[model samples]
Target: WRNTETSPETLSDSQLRGLGIVEGADGTINFESGIVVTGRVEKILRRDGKLMLIGFSNCSAKQGDRILFDPTWGTFDMAVGERISSVFNGAADKDAYNQIALVPKDRTIKVPSDENRKKLENLYAQVRDIRDRKVGCDRLGEIWETQQAEHAGDWLLSMQIFEILDEAGEQNDLKQKIVTFLNQKKLTNKDISTLIEWGFRLVTYHKVGLQTAAHGA
Candidate 1:
């Protein structure tokens, strides 16, 4: 098990963008285990619509490293069978399998579709207008966070955001909290409806934003 909350957020713009992959940028990365490593990015591969294989070359762990990657689930394992890669003393880059970090894929709850994308965009446009108000709009941030889901390449996180809001909306206490927020902000019933409708879309279609580009899904 590893922790990512404290993982060094330091990475290049490209490395930090989208999936925050560490390849193509020459530098060291600090994992939650506090193990620091430096290497050249070998491959930036996506798998199963939700994870990436961050591969590196000439990699080294701290003087005494404890990080370990299992070999069974990666293409690197096949390299050994083909006899193209080798391992020495369990070194991290002894072969292909040792050099990859399976980074989590960030995307929406459902694979984005053209129809859902347009509806979602229109809904967010309205949501954004509501957020521009002075009060009762903190609830609007939930919708804004969904935009982050699209950028992070993890729609599941986006879906979870909507899920939390939906759960809160179902409960009287939580729903009242949101209602009071809108009242304080002087937002209208239509505003509340838009917020509720956004959640409904998530529960129904589960889209964060329109997928403007094609990603290997």
Candidate 2:
């Protein structure tokens, strides 16, 4: 937090990996800086742009480092929050820190109280910093756009391939261009397989050029 540089390129792979972080591994993704907690992945969710969890609060929890869990099965994160809130107005959403998990308690008794809720609110409000949440729909749209474009490209390549099916003229050149474009789009394994299988052949891909009339090009 002291050195104010957020450029991701600033960190090397080893640096990030050293923090128990791995790229492209799907699990809990911590986009914000906060107390670094490490444990088996538990329930993770987004509530009002704040990433939340349902694991034991004392489990290797720290303050001011981004953390990711492998992901867990449960509605505990929200369920606990809402249940506590319902019983005694435990945690308010306006202040992101007002959550159920942060409540300190004895092992025997479990009851909601305003004082404990306030403490949690005050504690996280001062300590933890939740970042903005990313929209899954937005990411989905990006995938769609890239896929559509690739679909279009395959059609174009098919035309080229069809013409040069019997000759090497310009084939390797077009093939190289296609490879570069595919990498940029981050195509999935299945997408790559399908593209490779029918990319140049362009069977079901859509054409993006001008539609031809009876006497058009």
Candidate 3:
């Protein structure tokens, strides 16, 4: 059995490529494992949703990574035989299975619908916001460790900024934090830049952020 926590034992470059999941003819990425997350093709983004690739979001899933469908009574073992246009690896495109035409493993149902898309988006937004705050806290912690007490106070405020962001429920709400800083007018350009840089770095390194942007579903 493969360990999902640590990286699964390496399957070798060629072995991985040869796996039936590499890329499907109809873009229905079938894996050796039976987990599936589905959604509308949002836009395929690159480098973990930082850039564009074949994308999908707000759909359904099942088994292993199955956040969408629940195969409690049946299995997705049956082949549907529907053709997908383009197949790519990574999470962003996974949702495309809904927006684009797809032959499910069972081929019993058509791709997901707009209703599913919206529902998924709502979930996605909630999760994404949570992840973003975590990233911010991580960044603030890093900067805090390096600064002197004078600068430390502002960084401390940054931590509280995240608290407010958490309660606000949206990224736009971060404006209040920025305004608070501006009103105090205490932070230097260097400090501001450092905070922004660290925030991005935190997102790059944090698992939750990566999962949300990359997979969308």
Q: Please report the candidate that would top lDDT against the real structure.
A: 1
lDDT of 2 by residue, 1-217 (tens): 1132433324444544544434333222232434233443343333453322234322333234211111231111222224333322332433212222332121222343566556444432322221122122223223323434533422222222322321223345444554555555435344334323333322222221112222374
* Model 2 lDDT, residue 8, Cα: 32
Top candidate by TM-score: 1
Which window of 10 residues has the lowest lDDT sum in candidate 2?
A: 66-75
lDDT per residue (tens digit) for residues 1-217 in model 3: 1222222223332443443223222223333346454434433322321221333333444445423232231222211111232111111222322222222222132333456434433433443444455544334333323322323222323433443344444454454545455445334444334334433333233435446777986
**lDDT of every predicted structure (CA atoms):** 0.36, 0.32, 0.34
Deviating ranges (above 4 Å) for candidate 1: 1-22, 63-217
Per-model TM-score versus the true fold? 0.24, 0.19, 0.20
For residue 166, what is the lDDT in candidate 3? 42
Q: Model 2 reaches what TM-score against the true structure?
A: 0.19
> For candidate 1, what is the lDDT?
0.36
Candidate 1 per-residue lDDT over residues 44-139, each given as its tens digit: 544343223445565544423332322222221111111111111111122112232222122122333566455455444444344334334445
| Sort order, TM-score high to low | 1, 3, 2
In order of listing, the candidates' clash counts read 11, 5, 23
lDDT of 2: 0.32
